[model samples]
Target: MAGPNAPWHQKKNHPVRRHFPFVLLFALLGLSALASAPAAALEFELGAGPVDEIDGDGTWIATASWLTGQRHPWELAVGMIGARTQAQGVDTGDVYFVSVSRRLTWKRWFVQGGIAFTDSDNEVLSNHWQFRTGLGYDFGRFSLSVAHLSNANTGGRNRGETFALLQVAF
Candidate 1:
């Protein structure tokens, strides 16, 4: 059996394991923020795009997002993304993220940006700090947005990803 000097005990594998607790804490906080929002403040979005140009050798991408009711310029959102990509021998992967966005609107056009904590299953992508930005044109209850997600080179690989989305508010 390997002891303290074992390869498994090295810092590389331990990074994600060590950070698991922090991720859990952040998730909890995000949930609480969502809970605090009014029921009528929920928004849903669906997005799709090409994958390889963003992060991997995938052909297509799909994402779904839910944003909690807005408190002026601030809102909390949770998003799930799935990509059909061949990266690190995996044919598919998913990324789940929580973000706080600041939105500014003038008439029917809006711009939003925020930082996020991403948990990804693809070996080529990192499972931590990410940034997201997007702009959309709101048509009452419906909108179209173009957004991008990236680790900002915080990880070993940071190709980033982009999406074109259609959103609806209930």
Candidate 2:
């Protein structure tokens, strides 16, 4: 019978697995549109890096942020664009995370922290909530930084995801 037990069915197949790419595209487009608006001092950044595991093996990570620009040395941003990982023959599935963060800047250097709400509880993100933090240096339209995400021991496997990201600001 062509049912759940069929050869074409896989145990790891999430109901939404086939729609991930489309989801990613719409996210990117939405962020880009926000950045394209004529609002003054609006800022947008796109970043990618590696997702590290305790075993020293890692996965690729991508992220993006949209903020209200620099004002009074502090700003608020919506940081999102989820990530996925495959470890030990286990697919962590898609991670849908969104956070409202406070970005503080001093001269060309900046530090940010925020609380994130996530949709997946997997190897990398084992909780319904996560904390996001980053430190970086801005160079005109570009920046370099490291981003760290953790569950603060609220769930299983507190192993955090930390990576170096090169950001393009527009």
Worst ten-residue run, lDDT, model 2? Answer: 72-81
Clashes of each: 1, 0
lDDT string for model 1 (12-89, tens) is: 554445666886786677667667767677666665555444333545455555667563345566666675554555
1-170 per-residue lDDT for model 2 (tens digits): 34566452343453234444654564465456455545776776786766655454456666666766544223333344334433454456546565556667888888988766555667766765678888988897888888787898878976666767777877
**What's the TM-score of each model vs. the native?**
0.66, 0.66
Model 1's number of clashes is: 1
In model 2, the runs with Cα more than 4 Å from the true position are 1-38, 72-86
lDDT of 2: 0.62
Cα lDDT listed for each candidate: 0.65, 0.62
Which candidate gets the maximum lDDT versus the true structure?
Answer: 1
